[model samples]
Target: MAEPYYITTAIHYPNGKPHIGHAYETIAADVAARFQRMRGRKVRFQTGTDEHGLKMAQKARDLGITPRALADEMSSHFRVLFDRLNISYDRFFRTTEDEHHRASQAIWLAMEKSGDLYLDRYEGWYSVRDEAYYDESELTEGEGDEKLSPQGTPVEWTVEESWFFRLSKYQEPLLRFYRDNPEFVRPATRFNEVRSFVERGLRDLSVSRTSFDWGVRVPGTEDHVMYVWVDALTNYLTGLGYPDETEDFATFWPADVHLIGKDIVRFHAVYWPAFLMSAGLPLPKAIFGHGFLLNRGQKESKSLGNVTDPHELADRFGVDQLRYFLLREFTFGQDGSYSVEAIVNRSNSELANSFGNLAQRTLSLIFKNCDGVVPPISGHTDADTALFGHVDRVIFQEMPANYDTLAFAQALEAWIGAVYACNAYIDEQAPWALRKTDFERMQTVLATLYIVIAQLAVAVQPVMPETSAKLLDAMGLASELRDFEGIRSHWYPQLAESDFRLVKPKGLFPRIEMPAEADA
Candidate 1:
C-alpha cells in the first residue's frame, strides 16, 4: 500500500475579518491537496480558524459580544468564503472545538511529563495586538514612528504570569534535525532564518498568558491559557485524531507538508516540530513558508486601511480566474502586488487568447471538417511525432518530478507552449481548408489537435478547473481525460462517440478596459 499524504494550512487567527491574504494561503493549500489527489494519492487537507487567542478576547470586548459568539460568527464567514472559492478541504478543525482543546492540553501535559514546562514570571515587551511577546532589543523606543514593532504594530510593555516552554532545550536538537533532514524547512531563506535564530540560542518562550482567559488553559493551570501560536499549531495533529485514536494517527501523523505564511515561519518551523519531538511524535515532512501578497508598493495592512476584500475580486473576475492569475503572476515564494489591470491582462492574453482560443479553433475545425467526430490516429508527420513525444515526456516524466517541488506555474508554462504549438500546427496544416480535397490528411491533423488538448486539459485542471472542465465537455471527452496518467499515455484513446454537440464557445476570459488617465 502507498503511504497516505497529509497537508495543512495554518489555522487562521480570527482576530478580525479575514482578507485576501487568508484566501491566498487557503487557495495555495487547496491546489497542493488537489494536485496530490490527481497524482492518485489519498490526501487529507485540513484547514480552520484559530478562535481562542488574546486578539479574539479584544475583538469580543470591542464588539460587546462574548468571545465564543464572535468566534462562532467569524468562523461562518471563513467557511462561506472557502466554499465560494471552491476550496475542497477534507477537515476543518477549529481551535475552540473539543477535539482541539483536548489535543492542546494533551500536548502540554506530555511536555510537562517530559519536564519541558516550568512556572516563570514574564516581564517583557509584549504587543497584545500581535498576541506575541518580544525581547527588549526587538522593541524600539519612543514616538508615533520610532516605536513601530516588527509587524509595524506599536509596542507596549507587558508584565504578566506565564508558563514557559523550554524551547532552549530543543534548539540543538532542531539544528541537528536541519542537518539531518535539510528539506524540513523550505525556500532556503526560511530555513536559513530558522537556523540563524537557533544559532543565536533559543529563548524559553512564554507558552501561556495570564492576561487573557479566552484560550486553552495550560494543563492543570487555570490562570494561564496556552499562547495562540502553540494552541493554534496543535490543530494540525488534532485534526489527524492525535491523542485520541491510533488508526488515523498511524496513517497521517507525519504530514507531508505544512503550508504557511512567511510571517510565522518561526512558530511552524521551529516551535511546532519541537513540541512534537518533545512528545515523541514525528515531525511534518516539510514546512513551506510562502511569501505575502502586497498591494502596490506597501504591504496590505488592515490598520493602514489597505486591506483588499477577496470576495470583491472573486465577484469581478471569476474564482478560477483569480486562482489562475495568482499562480501565474508571481513565482511562488516571492511577494507579488495585485492590480486590477494585471488580473485582467493575464485573463485575456494568457487564458482567453492562448488557451481558450486554441480549444475553440481546434474543436470548431473538427466539427466543420471531420463531421464533429474525434478522428482516428493514422498518418504521422515529423511535427506530429515530435509534439506527441513532448507530451509524453512532460506529463509522464517532467511534470511528476516538478510536482514534488510544487512548481505548478512552471508546469503550466510548459503546457501553454504545447497549446501554442498545437495552434501553430493548425495553421500549417489548414485541416478545415483541406477537408474537401484531402480527407485522410485532414483526419490526421484533427486527431493530433484533439489529443494535444486532451493532454493539456489534464495538466492544467489543477490551476484552472472550470475552464478545463468545459474544454473536455465540448470535445465529448470522457471524465477520464481529467486523470493525470490517463491523458499522458497515447495521443488517441477510444473516446465515446456522442451526439454532435455544438457549443457556442463563450470567451472563457474577457479582456479588461482601463481609463487613459489611470495609466498615467
Candidate 2:
C-alpha cells in the first residue's frame, strides 16, 4: 500500500471576495497534492472557507444580512474560484458544517477534560481585522494616537467574560518541541520567528468570546462561542472525521504539512500545536508559511484600489499559465510581484516559445515526416545519448528532489533547462534536413525527441495538468503511463512498436498578448 500523505491550506476567511493571495496559496497546495499523488502516495487535500468570526459578523451587519446568509454567499465565491483554478482538494470544508461544529465542540470538551480550559475575565487589545488578540507589547501607535496590531490593523480595547485556555502551561513543552523538531516550521526565517515568540513567556489565551455569537458555540456553554482561530483550525481535523476516528482520520491524521500564508505562521506554529497537545492529538509534521503575492512590487489592498480579482487574471491568462507563472517567477518562500507584462512575458517565453514549441515542432515532424505514426529509433548518436542523460537526470532526479522540498521555482528552473536542452538538440540535429539526407536518422532523431517530450509532459503534470494532458493525449501516450515511475519505464519502445497513430498537434500554449494599458 502507498504511504498516506495529507496536506491542507489554511481555510480562507471569506469575509471578502477571493483575491490573488488566496489563489496563490491554494494553487500551491494543489500542486503539492498533485505531486504527491504522482509519486504514488495516498493523498488527501483539503481547503475551504473559515466562515465564523467577528469579521464575518461585522461584514454581514454592514450588508444587513444574517451571518449565515453572508457566509453562504461568500463561501460559494471561494468555491467557484477554486474550481476555476482547477484545485483538486478532496474536501472543501466549511466551519459552518454541522460535523465541523461537532468536531470543534468535541475538541473543546477534550481540552476541558485535560483541565486546560477555565472561565476568566478577558481584557486585551484585539484586532477585528486580524481576528486576533494582541499583547500590549506587540501593539504600536497609529495615526491620531490610535493603537494598531503588529500587522498595522486597527486595534481596540476589548473586555468581556470569556473562557481561557492555559496556553502558558504548554510554554516549556512548545519550546522543547521546537528544540527537538527544528523543522516543525519551514523556511528557517519563519521557524526563527515562531521560536522567538514561544521563547518569550506565553500568557493564557482567550479561547472563547462572549462579544460575538457568529462562531462555534462552546460545548457546554450557552453564551460563549469558541475563538475564531480555534474553530477555524479544527476544520483540518473535521475534514478527516476527527471525533469518530474514521478510516480517514486513522490513516491521514498528523498531516504531512499545513500550507499557509506567512502572516498566520504564529497561530499554526504555536497555538495549533499547543491545542493539539492539550487534546492529546499528534501535531502535524510541518508548517510552511509561504510569502505573499504583490502587484507590481506593491501589496494589493482595497484602499489602494489595486486589489486584483484572481478570476479576472485567470480569465485573461489561462489557468495553467497563471499557475505556472506564480510558481516559476518567485522563490517558493519569498514574496513575488506579478503584472500583466510579467505574466505575458513569462508565458510567451517559457510556455509558448519554449516547451510548447518543442512539443509542437517534435509532433509536427512526426506527423509530416513519419506518416503520423510513432517512429522507431534506428540508432542513437552521441548527441542523442547526451540529451537523454541530461533530461533523465533533470526529470527523474533533480526536479523531484526540489519539488519534494517545495522548491517550486528551482524545480521549474531545472525543468526549463531540460526543455532548452531538447530545443537545442533538435535544432542541431536538424531532423527536417535529415529527411532528405538520411530518412532513418531523421526517424531516429524524431523518435528521441518524442520520448523526451512525453517525459517532459509527465514531469510537468503537477503544475500544468490540463496542458500536459492535452499534449500527452495528442501524442497517444497512455493515461496510466503519466506518472514519475511510469514515465521512466520502457513504455516508449513499446509505444513505438504499437500501431498507434498521432493526430496533427494543436499548440498547448498560445502566445499571450500584453494588454494595451500594460504596454503604456
Candidate 3:
C-alpha cells in the first residue's frame, strides 16, 4: 500500500438543508480524494454533519423533537444527498457520536493541561446562524444602525460564563508558523489575508459555552458544553481516532489537507491550528479556502432565499453532468457563477458535443467497419505517433499535476484537449473513407483512436466516475483501469495487438433541454 493520506471537508451543520455551495466543496474534496486513491495512496476521506449548535437546538425545538432526533433526521438527508452525488467518504461521523464526544473532551483536557484554557465570562456579538462569536470590530453597521455580523447575519449580544482558548498567546507563534511554512494555508491571497488578520492582532477565543446545552460537554465541568466550532473542528481528529494513539491515529494524525469553504477560513486557519498547537499535535499539511458558489451571480445563502438544492439540480441534469459542470465550469479556489444556461451550455457543448460525440462516432465506426472489435494496428505514420505522444505528454503528466493542485478546470481543459486531438486525428485520417480502400491503414487509425478514447475514459473517472466507468466498460476495459499505471500501459493486454470483444457503445451524455430562463 502507498503512504497514508488523510483529507477532510468542513462538517456541514445539520440545521438547514444542503445547497449548491455545500455540494461544491464536498464535490471538490471528493475529486481530490479519488485522485489520491488512484495515485495509490491509502486515502481516508471523512465527511459528515456537525449536529450540535444553537441553530440545531432551536430547529429541533421548533419541530417538537429532541436535538438528537432532529440531528438524526437532518444528518440522514445530508447523507442521502452525498449518496446521490456519490461522495465516497470513509467515515460519516456525527458530533453526537460517543467517539467524537470523547475525542473533543480529550483534546480539551490537553489544552487545559497545557495552560491554554481558562474559565471566563464572554460578552460579545454572536451570530447563531453562523454559530460564531465575533469581535465588535468584526460587526458592521446594518439598516438603521443595527449592527450585523460580517456575514450580514443579525448579531445579538451574548454573555455567558465560558472557557477561553489562549489564541492571543499564539499570535506571534502563528505568524512565525505562517512565515516558516507558507503552504499551511493555500491560494496565497487567502493565506495573505489570514496573515494580515493575525498581524492586526488576535484575542483569546471562548472555547466552551454555558448558554447552549446542545454541544460536547467540557471534560471536567458539567455546566459548560464545548463551543460548537470547537467541537465541530475536532471531528477531523475524531475521524482519525485521536487522543488514544492508535495505529490509525499515528498514521493519519496530521491530515493531508482540510478542504474548506472560504467563509470558514478564520476558524480553520486561525483557531484550528492554535488548538492543535495547544494540544501539542502536528498541524494539517494544508488548509485550502476555496471560494463559494454563486446563485444568479450572487453569493448563495439561506437569508437570501436563493439556496439551490443540489438534488433538484442533479435531477434536471445528470449527476455526472452536474459534477462535470461544477468542476469544469469554473476555476478552483475562486468564486464561480452558475445558472441553468451555464450548465446546459457546458453539458451540451463539452460533455454531449466534445466528449460524448467523439466517443460515439469513433466507437460506431470501429464497430461497423472493424467488425465490432478492437482492430489491429498494422502501421503508424509520424502524425499517428505524435497524436499518441500528446496523450503521454499532456494527459498523463500535466493532468495529474492539475488534479494534485486542485486545478479542476485546468485539468479538465487538458483532458478535453486530448479528446479533441483524437477527434481531429480521426477526421484527418478519415478512417471511414480508408476502410473502403486501404483496409490496413483504416485498421491502424481505428486502433489508435480506441487507445486515445480509453485514455480519456480513465482520465475523467475521478470527476465523472459513473460515466467514465460506463465508457470503459463498453470498451471492454477492466475495472482496474482507473490507476495511472493502468492508463500508462495504454490499458495493457486489452490493447496488445489483438481483437477484443466490445459491448455495444451508447451515447455517454445526451444533450439537455435548456430551461427558458437560461436565455437571459
Whole-model lDDT for model 2 versus the true structure? 0.93
Give the lowest summed-lDDT range of ten residues in model 1: 491-500
RMSD values for the candidates in order, in angstroms, are: 2.1, 0.8, 1.5
Identify the runs in model 2 with alpha carbons over 4 angstroms from their true place.
none
Q: Which candidate is the best by lDDT?
A: 2
Cα lDDT of model 3 by residue, 1-520, tens digit? 6889898999998787787877888999999999988999999999999999899988988999999999998889999999999999999878889999999999999898899988889998889888888889889988996789877888889888988999999999999999999988888899999999999999889887787698898977998998898889999999888778788888887999999988899999999999999999998889999988888799866678887999999999999999989999889999999888889988998889988998898889877876787787776899899999998777679889999999999999998888888878978989889978999998888888888888888888889999988888788787776678887874544554456676567899988998766664
Per residue, candidate 2 scores C-alpha lDDT tens digits across 1-520 of 7899999999999889999999999999999999999999999999999999899999999999999999999999999999999999999988999999999999999999999999989998999999999999998889998998988899999999999999999999999999899899999999999988988889999988988799999978879999999989988999999899699999999999999999999999999999999999999999999999999999999999999998998999999999999999999989989899999999999999999999999999999988898988887989999999999999999989988889999999999999999999999999999999999999999999999999999998899999999888888889899999998899988888889898888898989988999988
Clashing pairs counted in every model: 0, 0, 0
**What is each predicted model's overall lDDT from 0 to 1?**
0.80, 0.93, 0.88
For model 3 the local lDDT of residue 506 reads 87
- TM-score for candidate 3, residues paired by index: 0.97
